[model samples]
Target: MSWITQKLPDVLFIQEGPGIRKYEYEENGYPMINVRCVQDGYIDMSSARCASMELATTKWKHFQVDEGDILYTISGTIGRSAIVKEADLPLLMNTSVVRFKSLTPDLDPKFVYYYFKTDLFIDELLGHSTGTAIKNVGPSHLKKMDISYPSLEEQKRIVAILDQAFTHIDKARALTEQNLRNVRELFESYLQQVFSLIGDRYVEEALDDACELITCGVAATPKYVDESEGVPFLSAQNVKSGKVVLDKYRHISKDLHAKLTKKNMPKKGDILYSRVGAGFGEAAVVEHEFEFSVYVSLTLIQPIEAKLDSYYLKYLLNSPQIKSLARSSITSSGVPNLNVKSVRKFLITYPALQKQKSVVRSIELMESEIGNLESIYQNKLLELDTLKKSLLQKAFSGELTKNMGEAAA
Candidate 1:
């Protein structure tokens, strides 16, 4: 059978929600589905806000989402879609989340949902979308969009094949994601075990006593320059949990670097700790003798080599216990900022220098193993996503039906 093409409005009824004001929102009433509630193929109503029953029934009655209705995000992150189930009934669509219902029996809602997942549809939608920062598409844009499908029977067959294929793909993707999580948790568990059990040989002291100097970096923003004319600058973002990342780092003029380094230079064996914003509590030891100046968001820790191992201190700072402590110490007034005084007061528990090195070696070895597993699982996830996209492309191109017929023969 050949495919028939029609405008989306001729086959489906498309409508977005009423613009609800903050005052219209309430503690209990009809659940309002927003763009955030719409995942790729399912609705996450957990974060859905509530609108008053009066508003839902009176002003927004026409916007009520029905069972089997497909919800597509029209603004911000465009083209993400989800099919509304029976359990999701009685929910009202909020702005930016448009609902689609089949206007003709020839169109299977599930088939249309799968088509939305296709790159062809998404690319067209994106092309028509407007906005530099947050892209948006109106119902009029969707109304003019083309939708192609075969007979009703063939549509159901395509949906069935896609359902089975995507089920397996999604299962594999879920397992891969869980494996990635497990690999990360393994490293965290090891860190927990190492730090939680303090032995008789362990000596507990404040970081102030164990470190030769603990100071933050320059408060003033440095004048940036070309790499050849300046030195690498470090910030909270440059410091990862266990290592420094310079791939996206900026360069500051030599004069500015020299001026900043006079008070807060990070040399070899020093620890760079992210002390503010999203990266707070993360620490990485400086293993190179290369010159760099840090931002105020980073703290420089020069550990007394005789008393504490630099790697040990770094691992400790990144440990679950210390991270929890650091979170508790964060200033409540502004952006999540960890005060330098909190770093000075941090309790450091350690054994002899040799034992500290031994612990570091063990953790590093385990980390290497976990890193390999993480890479494998991550790659598997990427592969699964590619497979899914390939299946969608084939399904929409009519090749999937042809392949299925050959298989049946």
Candidate 2:
């Protein structure tokens, strides 16, 4: 039979219960699990929730995950999943998730999880997934997917190899993540001190005092063309937890690019803040000369190089407190929006150039250390993935050893 017709057991899962209440609500059904919890290979319990048992029982009973069950997302992130550890067997999953376990032991659950995580799997998943907003594929669609594997013992061997390798990857990633978090905390602490150190000596100045440019994208959505048009666009999506994610982005036409440059062209180090919706105050420092695609969702802050330190101001705006204030300061619009006139009123204490340089350098050092750790972790992660794919190829090709039995454990 052609590899396309191969069969294996297919299962489904879902997100259950509200992770958190983003808006007002009364009847508490099961808290919905969100994409946030599924990042990396683990479900971040930090944001999960419990809802009314009776309601949850009725609404989310469709997709129940058990211990060792592998849960994959059905929408948005398409094919992203996590192994249900021993602790979370009873928890209900939601509509966007699916649980799968192969009927044939030749398909190791761990192997499946790793396979789904690969660049190859992602490509196939995206190709099969439906929708323009967020990708999605139903359980039936998943069951129909052609997958081939090896003998049960061979599958176990591959899973064993992967588990050992990824444990190291996981630890390295954990350390890097910790370092990143620590740097963020350090920045916050030092910023507080900086703001207070210059408190009494502060100058009350207009935002333009430190400005080379301050504006937002056109409020109107003009004509848009695909990447063929040779225009690139940046949106709130580019700003992910204060970092720019250029991998998945949109493009526009050459004509539209010309029009936007006539408006506001982003330069390296300019602070880009979200101007619309729930992401109203989020910001990312521009790191490249990419063309701006969607403007209505952002506010650009270009600081005066001589008078204002753009890096310092960018960090200030990225602070959680400032973002909270910016979100609250949104005016009445269809959705909340951070207007240039209203938001620029945000004030920061100015210190002497030397002090400013000192703080910026400190933050820069912290960022570098964190960046190094992040690189190690990311590389380890890639290595683990490569090992997994190799193991899969071996197992299916009948080269993996099945002798890791009671003796190897």
Cα-based lDDT for every prediction: 0.88, 0.65
Cα lDDT of model 1 by residue, 282-401, tens digit:
999888879998888999999999989998888899898999999999986678989999899998899999999999998889889998898899889888888888878888888887
C-alpha lDDT (0 to 100) for residue 301 of candidate 2: 82
Using Cα atoms with residue i matched to residue i, what is each candidate's TM-score against the true structure?
A: 0.85, 0.62
For candidate 2, lDDT tens digit of each residue in 121-148? 5676677788999887766566556565
In model 2, which regions exceed 4 Å deviation?
1-6, 9-70, 82-97, 101-165, 187-202, 206-215, 225-234, 237-271, 277-294, 302-312, 315-342, 352-377, 384-397, 401-409
Highest TM-score model number = 1
Model 1 poorest 10 in a row by lDDT: 400-409
Task: Indicate the residue-level lDDT of 76 in model 1.
Answer: 91
